[model samples]
Target: MKFLKIGDRNLLYPIIQGGMGVGISLSSLAAHVAGNGGMGIISTAQIGFREDDFYKNPIVANLRAIKTELQKARDLAAKVFENSKLTAKFLDILKNYTPFIGFNIMVATNKYADYVIEAVKAGADIIISGAGLPIELPELVEKGMAVSGNEKRTCIAPIVSSRKSAKVILKMWDRKYKTTADAVVIEGPLAGGHLGFSYDELNELGADTMTSRNYKKDKYDAEIKEIIEEVRIYEEKFGKKIPVFVAGGIYTKEDIAHVMDLGADGVQMGTRFVTTYECDAPDDYKQTYIDAKEEDIVITKSPVGMPGRAIRNDFMDRLKSGPIPIRHCHNCLALSVCDRKTIPYCITDALCSAANSDESHALLFCGSNAYRADKLEHVEDIMLELTEDMN
Candidate 1:
């Protein structure tokens, strides 16, 4: 059964390569995913982190990264289009060349709020949002128009962690905007970076007890089933259905099948995708995950006021156990909703440092199975490896 029937497409392979930021999972990873019969997502984040001499404005150095990333995504499209050897002879050159290129943009970013709109304008097939509540996604996307209508002008999918969150989003979407989610991704606690669960929740679920298990268990947590039922309620209320995709800590082919069995239309994977050759992440970043051990995975709070998962590294140790007072929140202007007014260090600084390959202060986001990715390979072979387990 196909889980990816958002508007028009029913992707046979429910594999959605999770989007990584700052040139981690750029166009090459996504392009190869689409080429191999899966949905590939491009992260429209500090994407230009590796642009060749692409610094013009010193004041907006923050935005310079985004420009570079977008350009990289575009350049990636060109390369994939050329390498496919499929001439522009087809009438639907886009459909023939770019199989399902989606963009994942964080709503809490200091970058442009209408980043998804820009992606739509850039001919992106879909936009996956996370990091914070994407309350204004529909209006943001509505402001622009798509170049073609293979699907809606452009589709938006907000990642949710619980059924309550799903219901709240649908209600907000219905009452405030009357728009429908093209799709939804239910991200569990196993995801990297900003987590959907709180520290207490992570602890209560036994996630805290098993940090050294090499992987976390979302299998019996019922997040996917709960989200499916919640989305069904929205469908019943609004008389429309929204496809549901599940992600977070999913690693094996059986994991994909289990989610599909539980009623998900798609599944998103982040950590394993980092091992791919087409992934735009730096060599050090990829190797870091490969070198990690089960005990190295840790859950900590983000500057955004959310609990997140990452590999325990020197930077985290410095941030946690340092003698300095961790009471500076220079960039905390309600950018991301958190209980605290400020945090010791700016999350933006840490993440940006990681994106720039500053391993000393870098924050590496990974799925629960991040330590399990032991080798590096090309995107095609990686996809085939995970899918082969299903076959």
Candidate 2:
């Protein structure tokens, strides 16, 4: 595959492991992917769920975990280079390589700006924000840079699903910050977790069915083209190339080639990575994806006020009957969007349950091709398979 250039770093393969939440993609997964030459990302959503004081002081715990996780990922990547049995080619790749470690912080989270600042201060190479339009991301990033006093400017990227969202974010950043995005991740309808598209739009796009593959190629390709064209306008104004990566429903080497041929600089995949041995999720969680069927994948409502794709389970079935009683608020999402009194259920609890391997009542988020996984694999092997056919 072609190298994915972001600022000064050239990722060996134009592939990014999409960040999964609540305990899924952490130090282990991120480190392995980065070591293998892909941009590895850790999800900062309730990252400290295992901490003793998480429920009592969620913000403090998460902020502390941010530093810990990033350090752990770097350390893990370093250990790979220390191995005595490394191949000559692997040794060559490590000779001058610095693992590209990043964090995915949702814009809808409570204290969104705080999380951004914490991630930057903790020395994240890049921060990818989504779950809402990151309108003030540039401002937050600048603030973080100032607070950290770090020599290297932390790169920022916003996740957008359509040309309109892309245009709005880029124009706002240009007008306000006199800058454009370092990169852009275009997430489509078939993505896991909280999707940007409306429920109606996703339904019309046929995001959940086997036919969605054809839909992505024939119909979604137009949307991808439009967004790339919009980004090109800002690229010219800023006099730099802003790489665009496409996420959702990207499973194989062919998927990577198709999106690249359609103008995407790279591909971001989440579901396929969950089955990797190095992924932070429990074995049961990974098995959920392996055991899932085409019919088991469904779209459900999220407390973040967006539609999410997940595997159908007892939890989802119960939600269909009525609003589940929320025992306590984790205060995870912004109060403006997720009011404790009005929301259906506590998203933090559900996702945390999934992370802890309580699959019966957990929110099992997965991409459209989640059912395609049949066995656990290694990150290095998966990375090779995805880029073997590319130049």
Worst window of 10 by summed lDDT in candidate 2? 80-89
Summarize candidate 2's per-residue lDDT along 1-391 as a digit string, tens digits: 2456787666767788999999999999998888777788999999999999998999889989999999999999766535423222566555776778899999888999999999989888899998888989888878898999987878888999999999999999999889889999999988888889886787677774442553545678899999999999998998888999999989998888889999999989999899999999999999999999888888788877788888889998888888888877777888888878778888998999999988766999889889999999998888767766654
Q: After aligning candidate 2 to the native by TM-score, how far in Å is the CA of 372 from where it should be?
A: 0.4
Q: Best-fitting candidate, measured by lDDT?
A: 2
Mark the 10 consecutive residues where model 1 has the least summed lDDT. Answer: 324-333
Global CA lDDT of candidate 2, please?
Answer: 0.86
Write one digit per residue (lDDT tens) for candidate 1, span 138-245: 877777564323345667788898878887887898899987787899887777767777777777666653353533355435767887988887767767667777
What is the Cα-based TM-score of model 2? 0.95
Regions of candidate 1 where Cα sits further than 4 Å from its true position: 1-3, 9-12, 50-97, 146-152, 209-220, 236-241, 323-342, 389-391
TM-score of every prediction relative to native = 0.82, 0.95
* Backbone clash total, candidate 1: 5
How many backbone clashes can be found in candidate 2? 0
